[model samples]
Target: MYVCICNAVKEKDFRGAARRCSGGDAEQVYATMGKVPQCGQCLEDAEDILFEERQLCTRLPAANACQGLRGLAPA
Candidate 1:
Protein backbone atom coordinates (compact mmCIF):
# COMPACT_ATOMS: atom_id res chain seq x y z
CA MET A 1 0.00 0.00 0.00
CA TYR A 2 1.05 3.61 -0.47
CA VAL A 3 2.45 5.02 2.74
CA CYS A 4 3.54 8.41 1.57
CA ILE A 5 1.64 9.79 -1.41
CA CYS A 6 3.88 12.80 -1.65
CA ASN A 7 6.95 10.62 -2.10
CA ALA A 8 5.18 7.72 -3.77
CA VAL A 9 6.60 5.46 -1.08
CA LYS A 10 5.25 1.98 -0.60
CA GLU A 11 4.92 0.14 2.69
CA LYS A 12 7.78 -2.16 1.82
CA ASP A 13 9.97 0.78 0.98
CA PHE A 14 9.06 2.35 4.27
CA ARG A 15 9.92 -0.87 6.08
CA GLY A 16 13.36 -0.92 4.56
CA ALA A 17 13.86 2.71 5.43
CA ALA A 18 12.61 2.12 8.94
CA ARG A 19 15.17 -0.61 9.46
CA ARG A 20 17.94 1.65 8.29
CA CYS A 21 16.75 4.52 10.42
CA SER A 22 17.23 4.58 14.20
CA GLY A 23 14.60 3.65 16.80
CA GLY A 24 11.85 3.33 14.21
CA ASP A 25 11.54 7.07 14.02
CA ALA A 26 9.29 8.12 11.15
CA GLU A 27 11.09 11.38 10.48
CA GLN A 28 14.46 9.70 10.44
CA VAL A 29 13.06 7.00 8.18
CA TYR A 30 12.05 9.61 5.62
CA ALA A 31 15.39 11.39 5.72
CA THR A 32 17.25 8.11 5.49
CA MET A 33 15.25 7.17 2.42
CA GLY A 34 15.85 10.53 0.81
CA LYS A 35 12.16 11.41 0.91
CA VAL A 36 10.52 14.43 2.47
CA PRO A 37 7.01 14.75 3.80
CA GLN A 38 5.01 17.26 1.77
CA CYS A 39 1.33 17.40 2.71
CA GLY A 40 2.11 16.10 6.25
CA GLN A 41 -1.12 14.14 6.44
CA CYS A 42 0.69 10.87 5.89
CA LEU A 43 2.93 11.31 8.92
CA GLU A 44 0.49 9.75 11.33
CA ASP A 45 -0.03 6.69 9.17
CA ALA A 46 3.64 6.48 8.39
CA GLU A 47 4.48 6.56 12.07
CA ASP A 48 1.96 3.82 12.71
CA ILE A 49 3.48 1.60 10.03
CA LEU A 50 6.93 2.27 11.39
CA PHE A 51 5.84 1.33 14.90
CA GLU A 52 4.24 -1.87 13.66
CA GLU A 53 7.26 -2.77 11.57
CA ARG A 54 9.64 -2.18 14.42
CA GLN A 55 7.49 -4.13 16.83
CA LEU A 56 7.33 -6.99 14.38
CA CYS A 57 11.08 -6.99 14.00
CA THR A 58 11.59 -7.25 17.74
CA ARG A 59 9.10 -10.07 18.09
CA LEU A 60 9.94 -11.98 14.94
CA PRO A 61 12.92 -13.84 16.26
CA ALA A 62 10.83 -15.11 19.12
CA ALA A 63 7.68 -15.63 17.15
CA ASN A 64 7.25 -19.15 18.47
CA ALA A 65 6.98 -17.78 21.95
CA CYS A 66 3.51 -16.47 21.22
CA GLN A 67 2.42 -19.19 18.85
CA GLY A 68 -0.12 -20.62 21.27
CA LEU A 69 -1.04 -17.39 23.03
CA ARG A 70 -4.56 -16.03 22.81
CA GLY A 71 -5.49 -12.57 21.59
CA LEU A 72 -2.01 -11.82 20.36
CA ALA A 73 -3.12 -11.80 16.78
CA PRO A 74 -2.85 -9.02 14.31
CA ALA A 75 -5.67 -6.59 14.02
Candidate 2:
Protein backbone atom coordinates (compact mmCIF):
# COMPACT_ATOMS: atom_id res chain seq x y z
CA MET A 1 0.00 0.00 0.00
CA TYR A 2 1.23 3.46 -0.84
CA VAL A 3 1.50 5.43 2.36
CA CYS A 4 3.16 8.53 1.01
CA ILE A 5 2.33 9.29 -2.57
CA CYS A 6 4.38 12.43 -2.54
CA ASN A 7 7.57 10.56 -1.86
CA ALA A 8 6.47 7.33 -3.49
CA VAL A 9 6.89 5.58 -0.18
CA LYS A 10 5.12 2.27 0.23
CA GLU A 11 3.98 0.63 3.45
CA LYS A 12 6.81 -1.87 3.41
CA ASP A 13 9.37 0.84 2.91
CA PHE A 14 7.81 2.87 5.66
CA ARG A 15 7.84 -0.11 7.99
CA GLY A 16 11.54 -0.65 7.30
CA ALA A 17 12.20 2.98 8.00
CA ALA A 18 10.10 2.82 11.16
CA ARG A 19 12.18 -0.04 12.44
CA ARG A 20 15.42 1.76 11.63
CA CYS A 21 14.22 4.99 13.20
CA SER A 22 15.44 5.30 16.78
CA GLY A 23 12.73 7.69 17.83
CA GLY A 24 10.03 6.00 15.76
CA ASP A 25 9.13 9.37 14.38
CA ALA A 26 7.22 9.73 11.15
CA GLU A 27 9.28 12.69 10.03
CA GLN A 28 12.45 10.83 10.78
CA VAL A 29 11.28 7.94 8.67
CA TYR A 30 10.75 10.26 5.76
CA ALA A 31 14.08 11.89 6.38
CA THR A 32 15.84 8.57 6.39
CA MET A 33 14.39 7.89 2.96
CA GLY A 34 15.63 11.23 1.70
CA LYS A 35 12.06 12.42 1.24
CA VAL A 36 9.66 14.84 2.79
CA PRO A 37 5.93 14.97 3.33
CA GLN A 38 4.25 17.15 0.80
CA CYS A 39 0.64 18.30 0.60
CA GLY A 40 0.33 16.93 4.15
CA GLN A 41 -2.36 14.46 3.12
CA CYS A 42 -0.32 11.33 3.80
CA LEU A 43 0.83 12.44 7.24
CA GLU A 44 -1.95 10.71 9.14
CA ASP A 45 -1.59 7.38 7.38
CA ALA A 46 2.18 7.57 7.54
CA GLU A 47 2.05 8.26 11.25
CA ASP A 48 -0.37 5.38 11.77
CA ILE A 49 1.89 2.97 9.90
CA LEU A 50 4.93 4.25 11.77
CA PHE A 51 3.18 3.75 15.10
CA GLU A 52 2.14 0.17 14.28
CA GLU A 53 5.58 -0.73 12.93
CA ARG A 54 7.32 0.83 15.91
CA GLN A 55 5.13 -1.20 18.28
CA LEU A 56 6.02 -4.39 16.44
CA CYS A 57 9.71 -3.53 16.38
CA THR A 58 9.76 -2.86 20.11
CA ARG A 59 7.93 -6.08 20.96
CA LEU A 60 9.89 -8.34 18.62
CA PRO A 61 13.21 -8.04 20.47
CA ALA A 62 11.57 -8.76 23.78
CA ALA A 63 9.63 -11.67 22.29
CA ASN A 64 12.83 -13.16 20.94
CA ALA A 65 14.58 -12.67 24.26
CA CYS A 66 11.71 -14.43 26.03
CA GLN A 67 11.96 -17.35 23.64
CA GLY A 68 15.68 -17.60 24.29
CA LEU A 69 15.06 -17.53 28.07
CA ARG A 70 12.44 -20.27 27.75
CA GLY A 71 15.14 -22.67 26.66
CA LEU A 72 17.26 -21.73 29.70
CA ALA A 73 14.54 -22.39 32.25
CA PRO A 74 14.86 -25.40 34.57
CA ALA A 75 13.38 -28.48 33.05
Candidate 3:
Protein backbone atom coordinates (compact mmCIF):
# COMPACT_ATOMS: atom_id res chain seq x y z
CA MET A 1 0.00 0.00 0.00
CA TYR A 2 3.02 2.24 -0.29
CA VAL A 3 2.32 4.81 -2.94
CA CYS A 4 5.49 6.86 -2.74
CA ILE A 5 8.27 4.71 -1.40
CA CYS A 6 10.68 7.55 -1.86
CA ASN A 7 8.80 9.41 0.82
CA ALA A 8 7.41 6.40 2.62
CA VAL A 9 3.90 7.54 1.86
CA LYS A 10 1.27 4.84 2.13
CA GLU A 11 -2.02 4.69 0.25
CA LYS A 12 -4.06 5.65 3.29
CA ASP A 13 -1.88 8.68 3.88
CA PHE A 14 -2.12 9.59 0.22
CA ARG A 15 -5.90 9.36 0.32
CA GLY A 16 -6.05 11.64 3.32
CA ALA A 17 -3.81 14.15 1.61
CA ALA A 18 -5.78 13.84 -1.62
CA ARG A 19 -9.00 14.75 0.17
CA ARG A 20 -7.40 17.89 1.52
CA CYS A 21 -5.89 18.67 -1.88
CA SER A 22 -7.95 21.29 -3.68
CA GLY A 23 -7.18 20.24 -7.25
CA GLY A 24 -6.60 16.55 -6.69
CA ASP A 25 -3.25 17.06 -8.37
CA ALA A 26 -0.61 14.43 -7.82
CA GLU A 27 2.13 17.03 -7.43
CA GLN A 28 0.00 18.99 -5.04
CA VAL A 29 -0.69 15.90 -3.03
CA TYR A 30 3.02 15.32 -2.67
CA ALA A 31 3.49 18.92 -1.69
CA THR A 32 0.76 18.61 0.90
CA MET A 33 2.75 15.83 2.47
CA GLY A 34 5.98 17.83 2.38
CA LYS A 35 7.50 15.40 -0.08
CA VAL A 36 8.11 14.95 -3.78
CA PRO A 37 8.47 12.11 -6.29
CA GLN A 38 12.12 11.20 -6.34
CA CYS A 39 12.43 8.18 -8.71
CA GLY A 40 9.22 9.00 -10.63
CA GLN A 41 8.11 5.37 -10.48
CA CYS A 42 5.13 6.04 -8.23
CA LEU A 43 3.75 9.06 -10.10
CA GLU A 44 1.27 7.06 -12.15
CA ASP A 45 -0.06 5.17 -9.17
CA ALA A 46 -0.20 8.33 -7.13
CA GLU A 47 -2.13 10.10 -9.85
CA ASP A 48 -4.55 7.19 -10.12
CA ILE A 49 -5.15 7.21 -6.39
CA LEU A 50 -5.70 10.95 -6.39
CA PHE A 51 -8.14 10.68 -9.29
CA GLU A 52 -10.13 7.92 -7.66
CA GLU A 53 -10.26 9.78 -4.37
CA ARG A 54 -11.46 12.90 -6.13
CA GLN A 55 -14.18 10.91 -7.89
CA LEU A 56 -15.43 9.47 -4.63
CA CYS A 57 -15.37 12.91 -3.06
CA THR A 58 -17.66 14.24 -5.74
CA ARG A 59 -20.00 11.24 -5.81
CA LEU A 60 -20.66 10.86 -2.11
CA PRO A 61 -23.43 12.73 -0.32
CA ALA A 62 -22.45 16.16 1.02
CA ALA A 63 -22.84 15.17 4.65
CA ASN A 64 -20.62 12.15 4.24
CA ALA A 65 -18.27 13.58 1.70
CA CYS A 66 -14.57 13.23 2.48
CA GLN A 67 -15.30 11.52 5.77
CA GLY A 68 -13.45 8.48 4.47
CA LEU A 69 -13.99 6.52 1.26
CA ARG A 70 -13.80 3.06 2.67
CA GLY A 71 -15.49 -0.08 1.26
CA LEU A 72 -15.99 1.33 -2.28
CA ALA A 73 -13.98 -0.41 -4.96
CA PRO A 74 -12.27 1.54 -7.71
CA ALA A 75 -14.42 1.89 -10.86
Candidate 4:
Protein backbone atom coordinates (compact mmCIF):
# COMPACT_ATOMS: atom_id res chain seq x y z
CA MET A 1 0.00 0.00 0.00
CA TYR A 2 1.26 3.44 -0.88
CA VAL A 3 1.55 5.54 2.22
CA CYS A 4 2.99 8.65 0.72
CA ILE A 5 2.11 9.24 -2.89
CA CYS A 6 4.09 12.43 -3.15
CA ASN A 7 7.30 10.79 -2.05
CA ALA A 8 6.51 7.39 -3.53
CA VAL A 9 6.95 5.71 -0.19
CA LYS A 10 5.11 2.49 0.48
CA GLU A 11 3.70 1.17 3.76
CA LYS A 12 6.44 -1.43 3.97
CA ASP A 13 9.05 1.17 3.25
CA PHE A 14 7.88 3.33 6.10
CA ARG A 15 7.64 0.30 8.39
CA GLY A 16 11.19 -0.74 7.51
CA ALA A 17 12.49 2.72 8.11
CA ALA A 18 10.61 3.00 11.37
CA ARG A 19 12.02 -0.30 12.57
CA ARG A 20 15.55 0.79 11.68
CA CYS A 21 15.16 4.25 13.18
CA SER A 22 14.86 4.88 16.88
CA GLY A 23 11.80 6.23 18.69
CA GLY A 24 9.54 4.77 15.97
CA ASP A 25 8.53 8.32 15.22
CA ALA A 26 7.02 8.72 11.82
CA GLU A 27 8.82 11.98 11.15
CA GLN A 28 12.15 10.55 12.14
CA VAL A 29 11.57 7.49 10.00
CA TYR A 30 10.71 9.72 7.10
CA ALA A 31 13.94 11.61 7.64
CA THR A 32 15.87 8.37 7.71
CA MET A 33 14.19 7.40 4.45
CA GLY A 34 15.40 10.65 2.86
CA LYS A 35 11.89 12.03 2.64
CA VAL A 36 9.42 14.06 4.65
CA PRO A 37 5.69 14.41 4.82
CA GLN A 38 4.35 16.81 2.28
CA CYS A 39 0.52 16.70 2.21
CA GLY A 40 0.20 15.45 5.80
CA GLN A 41 -2.65 13.15 4.79
CA CYS A 42 -0.46 10.13 5.13
CA LEU A 43 0.91 11.12 8.49
CA GLU A 44 -1.69 9.25 10.54
CA ASP A 45 -1.45 6.09 8.47
CA ALA A 46 2.31 6.25 8.52
CA GLU A 47 2.32 6.67 12.25
CA ASP A 48 -0.02 3.71 12.64
CA ILE A 49 2.28 1.54 10.56
CA LEU A 50 5.30 2.77 12.45
CA PHE A 51 3.66 1.91 15.75
CA GLU A 52 2.66 -1.56 14.58
CA GLU A 53 6.11 -2.27 13.22
CA ARG A 54 7.78 -1.06 16.37
CA GLN A 55 5.49 -3.18 18.50
CA LEU A 56 6.30 -6.28 16.46
CA CYS A 57 10.02 -5.61 16.68
CA THR A 58 9.90 -4.98 20.41
CA ARG A 59 7.85 -8.06 21.28
CA LEU A 60 9.91 -10.61 19.36
CA PRO A 61 12.84 -10.66 21.75
CA ALA A 62 10.59 -10.86 24.77
CA ALA A 63 8.60 -13.72 23.27
CA ASN A 64 11.78 -15.62 22.41
CA ALA A 65 13.16 -15.09 25.88
CA CYS A 66 9.97 -16.48 27.35
CA GLN A 67 10.22 -19.52 25.13
CA GLY A 68 13.78 -20.10 26.26
CA LEU A 69 12.74 -19.79 29.90
CA ARG A 70 9.91 -22.26 29.36
CA GLY A 71 12.39 -24.83 28.11
CA LEU A 72 14.58 -24.25 31.17
CA ALA A 73 11.72 -24.38 33.69
CA PRO A 74 10.13 -27.83 33.00
CA ALA A 75 13.21 -30.00 32.64
lDDT by candidate, in order shown: 0.69, 0.66, 0.76, 0.67
Instruction: State how far residue 38 of model 2 sits from its true place (Å).
Output: 0.8
TM-score: model 3 vs. ground truth = 0.79
Models ranked on TM-score: 3, 4, 2, 1
User: What tens-digit string does per-residue lDDT give for candidate 3 at 1-75?
Assistant: 899888999999998887766563688779978998899999899889877886776677473546544443433
Cα lDDT tens digits, model 4, 53-75, are 65565567455322212212110
Show model 1 residue runs off by greater than 4 Å. Answer: 61-75
Model 2 CA deviation exceeding 4 Å by range: 62-75
Q: Candidate 3: where is the Cα deviation over 4 Å? A: 61-75
Q: In model 4, which runs have C-alpha deviations exceeding 4 angstroms?
A: 62-75
Q: Estimated TM-score per prediction?
A: 0.72, 0.74, 0.79, 0.75
lDDT of 4: 0.67
Candidate 4 or 2, higher TM-score: 4
Best by lDDT: 3
Q: What global local distance difference test value does model 1 have?
A: 0.69
How many residue pairs clash in model 4?
A: 0
What order do you get sorting by lDDT, best first? 3, 1, 4, 2
Compose the digit string of candidate 2's lDDT tens values, residues 32-60: 78998988899888887766664554556
Which run of 10 residues does model 3 get worst, by summed lDDT? 66-75
Tell me, what's the RMSD of every candidate? 7.2, 9.0, 5.1, 9.2
Clashes of each: 0, 0, 0, 0
